[model samples]
Target: MSPPPAVWVSGLRKAYASHLALAGVDLAIPEGEFFGLLGPNGAGKSTLINILAGMVHRSSGRAEIFGFDVERDFRRSRQMLGVVPQELAYDPFFTVREFLRLQSGYFGLRHNDDWIDELMAELDLADKADANLRSLSGGMKRRVLIAQALVHRPPVVVLDEPTAGVDVELRQGLWRFMRRYNQEGHTVILTTHYLEEAEELCSRIGILQRGRLIALDAKDHLLARFTWRVLTVTFDKDPGPLPETLAGFLSGAGENTLVLRLDQSRHSLGAVLTALQDLPAQILDLHVQEPDLEDAFTDILGNMGLEQP
Candidate 1:
């Protein structure tokens, strides 16, 4: 038989006073998949993560990790998952090495020094291993938090805004390590506002909006469904005024430039160029911008009648 999904949710719901944080959401992430969970602020992404991490109780329905029910088999489920939370919380007195060792002990692990050391090195925290948490920079502390979550070697890893407040160097380092880790068959669930990062890493993506799972599909499929290409035209001199037919497709404008949204099914680059020929603008340069994950995300949210960021 096929192995159970690395993570599963069914009819999950969470309520706070009169507000519903999660409204009957369902998701299934296969083992070894790199999945991205994206949503706007006040969406249920964090609430759902908190529920799976056993930090918050769900109002109804179920969550499971590797077929272990989150509520009934809490211990086993928790043991199989490692979560790097968005908040920066740590004991100021503890050194980086001490923190990870303590975290491993919390999961009933003993003699975990080797794994702890490896994690520190992987995260570029080896040089700061003996440094106290209070003395570390924000980015360094974030790396330590990631190490702490992985010290126990859980099969499933959840990273909630892991690269937030981190510098480009650290962010790149973390991505490299995570990519390698995920390629080794460990499941990774990431939630990030960096749509580009999600586009590069995640195989599948789930979009949450106002407590509902609005869209879920392979990354490419999602982009194909709602994203459109953009054609940017630059003129050598003033284009006078755009012709009526060509002006209809104008999505944006810059000094001597016009941006047009193109749907593959309805319009082609050849057609756009042909229409531009009749205009007074002498095309100095033309560029085609392919659709990306950010466009897909905005399109999805807009379709759902939510305010797009």
Candidate 2:
């Protein structure tokens, strides 16, 4: 028989007194897939992840990891999953190596030093191996958190805002590590505020809005839903005011630059170009940018009469 889905949830809901953090979310992630969970703050992304990690009890519904029910088969399910939490929780007294060893021991991995060393080297934490946890910089600490989560080499990994507050270098390093593991048949799931990161890393994305799953689909499909291409033009002279015919498409106006959104279905690029040529301002340069994940995400939320948080 085929192995069970890496993660599966049905009607998952989590409520806290006055707030319903999750509202009946149903999702299934197959093995070897890189999934992105996206949402604005207070949109229930973290709550959903907490429920799946068994750190918070759900108000209703079922969740499973590799066919093991998260609640009923806690040990097996937990063993199959690793989570790099949003918080930086660690003991101050222990050295980096000591802390990692303790984490491995927690997972019944007393002889996991080889893998621990590999994690440190890959994450650029090898040189700080003997430093006290409290002495490490924020970026170094984040790396340790990532290494801590992976000490057991779980089949499924969930990185909750893994790159938050980190430098570009650390962010890229983390992405490479996750990408390599995902290619090796590990399921990688992450919740991030960076739309560009999600666009580049995730194959599938699920967007949450105010405790509800508003959108879920392949990244490319979501991007395709955005019917407009961005048109940016730099003019040799400032255009005081655009003509009535072109004003509707003008999304942004600068001293000598105009940025417009041209809908392929309703407005053609060539037509827009022709209209620009007729403008009072002389165009010096122009660029047509294809729709991206951020555009699609904004459009989706806009159609729902909601603002991006």
Candidate 3:
């Protein structure tokens, strides 16, 4: 039989008292695929990741890593999966190298010094290898967390907001390192609030709303699904209130500029210009911005009764 998907979950559910954290969520990510999981603060993104990491017990359903069931085959599944959590949690007593070594030892990797050195070196943590975890800065702690997760060279890696609060340079470096490992045949599952980062790195995107999978498709398909465009018009003079026909489409307004949100299937650009003819003000400039991942994301969230941020 062919090897199972790198990561698979079926009918996953997690309940805490009356509130349901994850409601029958099913996901399958193939090996070497760069997958993105996106959701708002309480969208169960963290709950799902915790379940897969074996940190939280699932209320119902199956979760597997490389075909190994997470619960029954916990050892194998956990060993093959590495997670860089959002929390900057670590043992204050241990140094960077010592912490990584302890993490490696958890998987019966008694002699992982060579790989440990490589991880620290690649992550630019060699200089701080002997520094106590508590003494390191937040950025350095994040790097050490990544190193610990990767110490055993797992085939599947889950990055839960790995770049949260980090500087742009560090964030860029993190992506480069992740991309390099992903190209080396490692499956990468990224969960972040940053839609743009997900848009650039992930081939497949899955969005979760209040305990539900709201959208799942390739990045391009998701973008193409929403047929909308934003048009910004600059008037040479102060154009008072716009015509009724164009007023409804107005999404933004400035001193002498107006931005219109147009559903291409329903509103035509010609209609916008025709309505604007009623104004005596001359058109200084006009620009049309195409819909991107953010637009699609907002549309999805808005339709589900939640305001998109």
Candidate 4:
């Protein structure tokens, strides 16, 4: 028999008084897949994640982790799932090692020092192993939270805004670790405002809007749907006026530079070059950028008449 999905949600809904946080979301993430759950603020990404983690009760529908119902088999489901929340919650008095060990114990894992040590080394927390949580820097503390989530070696991991306040170097490191973990046959679900990161790491993406999933597909497919290209041209001299044909395509302009948007099916690179050649200015540099995840995301939301967050 095939293995159960890493995460499964059917008609999931959550209501807070008059507000409905989730309006019947249905999703399934297979084992070993790196999935991205994206949305603007108040789109219900966190609410769904909380329900899967058993931290919040769902108002309706069902959620499961590895086929174990989140509510009916809470303990078993929780044991197979690891979550890194957006907030930093920790016992300041506990040392890094102590905190991780305590988290392992909570999952009924005894003598899990081997995995704890491995996690510390992998996350670059070896030096801070004995330091009190209160003494660690914010970046170090974040690493500790990641390690704490994995203390029990859960097969499914969920990270919500893990790199929000982290520096570029730390963000790169976190992705490296996550990529390696996912490659080893573990499932990873990520939610972030960083479209570039999601574009690079996630195999599939689900975008939510106003408590409903508006888009879900492979990263490449989503990007391909835009069918647009960005052309950035730097001129050697100030071009006084753009030809009417070229001017209509201009998206932005700066000092001796022009940015144009091209619809792939309607416009060709050769045509753009010919238009530029007709101008009185010499082209210093030109860059043609393919449509990316951010562009697709913006276009999708715009078409739906929703404001991006």
Predict model 1's lDDT versus the native: 0.91
Query: By TM-score, is 1 or 2 better?
Result: 1
Candidate 4: lDDT over CA atoms? 0.93
- Model 3 spans > 4 angstroms off: 239-252, 264-284, 307-309
Q: TM-score for every candidate vs. truth?
A: 0.94, 0.93, 0.89, 0.95
lDDT of 4 at 307: 89
Of 1 and 3, the candidate ahead on TM-score is 1
Can you write out model 1's per-residue Cα lDDT over 80-147, one digit (the tens) per residue?
99999999988998999888888989999989998888888788889998999999889988988888
Q: For residues 230-260, what per-residue lDDT tens digits would candidate 3 score against the true structure?
A: 8999999888888888888989999899899
TM-score of 3: 0.89
Tens digit of per-residue lDDT, candidate 2, span 46-112:
9888887889998999999999988889899999999999998879999999999999998998898
- Model 2 misplaced regions, further than 4 Å: 238-248, 278-281
Q: For all the candidates, what are their Cα RMSDs to the real structure? A: 1.7, 1.9, 2.7, 1.5
User: Per-model C-alpha lDDT, please?
Assistant: 0.91, 0.91, 0.92, 0.93
Worst 10 contiguous positions by lDDT, candidate 4: 220-229
Residue ranges of candidate 1 with Cα displaced over 4 Å: 241-245, 275-281
Model 3: lDDT equals 0.92
3 or 4, greater by lDDT: 4
